[model samples]
Target: MAVTYLMLARLPEGGLGAFDAYESAVLPLLAEYGGRLERRLRTLDDRVEAHLISFPNSEDLAAYRADPRRSAAAPLLESSGAAVELLAVRDI
Candidate 1:
């Protein structure tokens, strides 16, 4: 079964750029693990950003999470002071 994720990130004013850089670097890594980015959105005020991501299965998603490339980008997120939330979701 496929699995989907809803990621909501609260960005700090100073860190938004850093967060964007992080996403640019890491989002592409999804393909290596049978994953895709369905949608990405951001508030006009730039305070929040959301992403809809899907993977073939939970295992693939887990592997993506463990990928060193993604891990290496952690500092970008940390420096951006972004608070992130990821949730599993389903389409009705």
Candidate 2:
């Protein structure tokens, strides 16, 4: 069973920079966990700022979530006040 994880993020004010930094450091770590950057940076609207990322499976997604690198990046994301919405879907 292959699962997909979709992450939707709403960056806080002055958070894009922090998000960028986090992404730079965490992206590779994600790959190490069997996750691929299906969508790195995506712009939702000109006025609103948000991003969507997809992972290959739940295992990879979980690995990314539990990774120490991700832990390190947590503060930056928190400081940026980024809102994260996660959805996990198993392939039918």
Candidate 3:
């Protein structure tokens, strides 16, 4: 079965200056890993974001996780002092 994920994040004191760059880099890469960005939402504060993502399967998810290029967003996030939470969703 396909797998889904929920992600919530809080950005740094400087706010969303780097969000566009991060999104640009990460979103395109998803297709290569059989992943999809279901939805992305940003708060009015511009200091937080959330995502709904899905993947073909656990293997695809694992491959994406293991990819070094996947860390493309890491610098933006780390420098921003971001806080991220991810949850796996399964059928009820």
How accurate locally, in lDDT, is each candidate?
0.95, 0.66, 0.81
Residue pairs in clash, model 2: none
Which residue pairs clash within candidate 1?
none
Error of 2 at 47 (Å): 7.2
RMSD of each: 0.7, 3.0, 1.8
Candidate 3 segments whose C-alpha is farther than 4 A from its true place: 90-92
Q: Which digits, one per residue and each the tens of the lDDT, describe model 2 over residues 40-67?
A: 4557541234333455656667777888
lDDT of 1 by residue, 1-92 (tens): 99999999999878889999999999999999999999999999999999999999999999999999989999999999999999999989
What lDDT score is found at residue 19 in candidate 1? 97
Cand. 3 Cα-lDDT: 0.81
Residue 54 lDDT, candidate 1, scale 0-100: 95
